[model samples]
Target: MPKSKRNKQVTLSKTTKKGRGHKELIINGIRDAAEKYSSIYVFNFQNMRNSKLKEFREQLQSSSKFFLGSNKVMQVAIGRSSSDEIKPNLHKVSKLLRGDAGMIFTNLSKEEVERLFNEFEGYDFARTGSIATEKVELKEGPLEQFTHDMEPFLRRQGMPVRLNKGVVELVSDFVVCEEGKPLSPEASRILRLMGNMMATFRLNLVCRWGSEDDFELYIDGPGDSDVE
Candidate 1:
């Protein structure tokens, strides 16, 4: 019986936790991006289009970074609710991560961010629940765009249409959608039938936070007022 060497116990860092590697990556990325960019914006997006967002990211690769993920993970990444901020005063950004939001880290000025958002929006067909931009109505007449064979399909979409003289014709004046109502499936179909698109992709920079200053609210939209 000689001497037995004592075993060394090791503790795992937060980054090494199982199934949480992505969370750790988010935290590290936030810290690194904060150090590199002079401005950080909290943004809310309508209609998530992955491909378009990818292109947008590519356009800003030279000087900006976009971080979109679970709000809780992002809250943790920025050292929210604690003095252990990754970067000075930047942790306050986590408070704005409440709903349908993401983060933009950039060295671009406020004007530049506004310009980028204004010039770089994608438009698409409105989906169910999207508010109609204008009143959509199908007048009582032949629809020259559609052929007679599409009558049954159009009828199934709640349209009062029939194949008359080898063309789809509305039997009556059917109001597909109103200006302020949530679009129904039938309304969405009618919009496509008429070759109309109602969804306009947009981004609102609700708040901005810097490493040295507190949150500044952007009041271009409703309910964005900062509490005194």
Candidate 2:
């Protein structure tokens, strides 16, 4: 070979940097929503599920806009102090933006927001490392739920399974998961195969601020002077 081009130089150019402009966009979006809507609520989530959230968003797209991302950026959008806040008393809501939380800018009444948040809950499969809510055991008998071809897969997932008479059977009683224990990767897979759902996704409101007088909803949230 005459000239080798194995290590050819490749220059990559783009209009926007990784995180620089995105942060500005988020700040602008929150600030804009603050003016577009009458109230702002800080809500925290447990076991967040993006698909479920997407569905909720669609349902509220007509009256509300949700923002979830960097808490720092969101705090900045609403202002961390009274002096710089885009709207009056919004800084108080900003203080409650810590942890797995997001903001909802909506024109709906306060009662409506509270009722919807209280009622919405999504159940999904528990992932690895999530605590098991209940015990799941497979009896030592034919596993009619699984096909014969799934024998190897079941075995690889730590199930004591065998193919007997063209049926999948467990050689011994197997405890797939135990209550109050962190689920292993194998245990999570087995639970999904058995159609067990353990994770619950829900949103709890922290505080609200906007055109109306600011008030706190959840006192257990992190913040200063009952604001967080």
Candidate 3:
């Protein structure tokens, strides 16, 4: 064979080997995730810039119980597995896979995972594109209406609402979800409140786990006479 032809064959072989290695790594990651975690959250982030993506990844790592590999590789590994328990959740997750996607696996229950997500809610201030479920944007109409309705509800919870240049703001720290935009001062307070409430609920559930007291707490709110 000519020298050029020989070189081409070697390059193709190397490329094929690299692809196989990557697939193996993905399969391994999925197996590990399944073995270690009872719950998984698959997030699809689209059009995120490099810097923002890095920040998001770092945030997830710090907050999540465990963050795993890409969806494509994990899907293949999951497909081969015999576990039916996570299968349903994984199938539902499959639908969310689009653009640049990632998975978070955790031994923590669904409620716990949700609490983590809520905790990390507003860490990234800038709009780094959007998730498939909620698109972030800046506008005037519905967001204003939402802010109006939310203000009273927030105050009832012992939180205050402030207005910044015609925009409603939360006086106390809270988690604010408007049309998906994360606005500071006003909106940040709302989001903080919501996140705190979710954390409280999760803590209550965890405290009452595996007892008749827990059952009563679940059926009715805390302070049930039978619980104690």
Q: What 10-residue stretch in candidate 3 is worst by lDDT?
A: 198-207
Candidate 2 C-alpha lDDT tens digits along 10-75? 779757555978889999898889889988889999999999999998989999999999899999
* TM-score for all models, in order of appearance: 0.83, 0.90, 0.37
Task: Go through the candidates in order and give the clash count of each.
Answer: 0, 1, 13
lDDT of predicted model 1: 0.80
lDDT leader? 2
After superposition on all C-alphas, the RMSD of every candidate to the true structure, in Å, is 10.4, 2.7, 15.9
Shift in Å, residue 95, candidate 3: 3.9
Alpha carbon lDDT of residue 191, candidate 2? 86
lDDT of each: 0.80, 0.88, 0.44
Assess candidate 2 and give its lDDT.
0.88
Candidate 2 regions with alpha-carbon error over 4 angstroms: 1-4, 7-17, 222-228
Tens-digit per-residue lDDT, 1-228, candidate 1: 966557655666556444578778888898788888888998888877777788898998898999987888888887775476676665557767767888999888888888998788877888989999999777899988888888898889888898877878898998989999999988898798777989877777777876565568774454334322
Badly placed stretches (over 4 Å) of model 3 are 1-18, 46-70, 80-89, 119-228
* Model 1, runs deviating above 4 Å: 1-18, 220-228
